[model samples]
Target: MRIRRVGAYALLLDCGEDEPDVPGRVEAWRAELARRRDRGELDAIEIVPAAATVLLDGVPDPAATARSIAGWTPRPAPVRGTAGVVEVPVTYDGADLPAVAEHWGASVPAVVERLAGTEFRVAFCGFAPGFPYLTGLPAALALPRLPTPRARVPAGSVALAGPYAGIYPTASPGGWLLVGRTGLVLFDVAADPPARLTPGTRVRLAPA
Candidate 1:
């Protein structure tokens, strides 16, 4: 793992190239950092994890933190406690269902079975407000982004692209292959946290 010092107050741990297939490792790192801070081993710092990176912001000393992270080995999947998993109800009736099934070489029902059966984790939140870039889709099922971006995708659209499954929190243009949708309010400006899917949260796509 390579640590890139972000200015003077943060360190970005690039776990991308080293562990391309295992994003849960990033979650492990985040959990460890939070554990350190909570136990008074680390100073006040924010542990923000992405697809394959964790950004430690508000670092008291970058070098010290880097050395500390470097000294530890990363753990495997099953990111955290069971309480973190959020069940998401999807309709499994996206317009792209046939296409996705064709790509997977499976029947429509079989595709739905595969999706609903997987346990997913929120690796990061990006692309839009409350939009979660979830991991857990196997590499063999990875698909490329749409050749032409859509002008607008409705809120609660559950989609997939390139080893990631995502939920569109609000209406906006996107390119991911839409396979289903949910009714849950994934984002609301008036909400306490605003975003329903924070990084490190677990997810399951349940057929609604």
Candidate 2:
């Protein structure tokens, strides 16, 4: 890992390189930082994670925080206690469903089976609030984003691009292929946590 200063209040830990399992490593660190922040080990205001980096925001001492993070080793998936795994019910009836099956040389049912069978983890939130970029999709299911992104993708759209599977928390523009739709509300600002799928949360896709 490489640590670098981001302006005055943040330290960015770059996990470096793209391995098939980089998302898992990033999730582990993101959880660890949360633990530290809660215990007063870190006085940062925000711990934001991405595919390959964790940004520690509002830190009092960037250098010291970087040193601490450097010495730390990644642990197994964090204990979320009662918040555990979230099951998302999806209706596999997307516009790209048939195309995706053709790309994979599999039938539509096979594609749905593969999607429902694999488990995914929330690596980070980006693009939009409460929109999580989930990792752990089987590599065989990975595909490139649409060449021409739709002007607007409806909320609750279950989409896939590369090795990530994500739910469209709110209606907006997106390029990920829509493979399904879910009824679960992924984002609600008035709710306790706002985001249903916070970082470190595990997810399962079930047929609705």
Candidate 3:
């Protein structure tokens, strides 16, 4: 890991080339930073994670904080349980489910099974609020976004693009292939954190 300043109050941790397991590494760093923040070791406002880097915001001393994190070894995150897990109940009936199954040479039930069986980790949050880019879809199941994005994808619409699976927190234009729908409210302004699927959270899709 390498740290560089992103201005005066922000620092970015570059974790080298992106890999299948990079999100886990980023989560480890984010958790450690949160611990330090709680202990008064660092003054940070936000710790945002992405595919290959962790952004530290509101840092009082970027250089010193960077040096401290560099010397610290990241610990392994919890592999199971509900510490950071979000269980989303899904209805596996989607407009593109048939097409997706055809693309994978699998039956409809097989597609749902494959998606529900995998464990995903939120790699980042972008494109829309509360919309997490989850990583963990098997390579055999990975596919590209639609050539023509829909003018507005419905809220709670579960979609997949590239190697990521995401839910539409609110109705908006999107290109990801719709695979399912859920009833969970992904974003609630009244909630403490707003976004239900924060970066580093483990996500599971359950048939409802």
Off by over 4 Å in 1: 18-20, 77-83
Cα-lDDT of candidate 2: 0.87
CA lDDT, every prediction? Answer: 0.86, 0.87, 0.87
Kindly report which residue pairs in candidate 2 clash with one another: none
lDDT of 2 by residue, 1-208 (tens): 7889999889888887566467777777888888877887878988889879888899998888888878888678744543667889999999999888988899999999988987778889989999989887666668999999999999999999888899999999999999999989999989988999988788988899
Model 3 residue 154 distance off true place after TM-score fit, in angstroms: 0.6
How displaced is residue 39 in candidate 1, in Å?
1.6
Cα deviation of 193, candidate 1, in Å: 2.3
39, model 2: CA deviation in Å?
A: 2.9
Worst 10 residues of 3 by lDDT: 15-24
What would the TM-scores of all predictions be?
0.92, 0.92, 0.92
Residue 185 of model 2, lDDT score: 94
**What C-alpha lDDT, on a 0 to 100 scale, does residue 115 get in candidate 1?**
93
Residue 105, candidate 3: alpha-carbon lDDT: 94
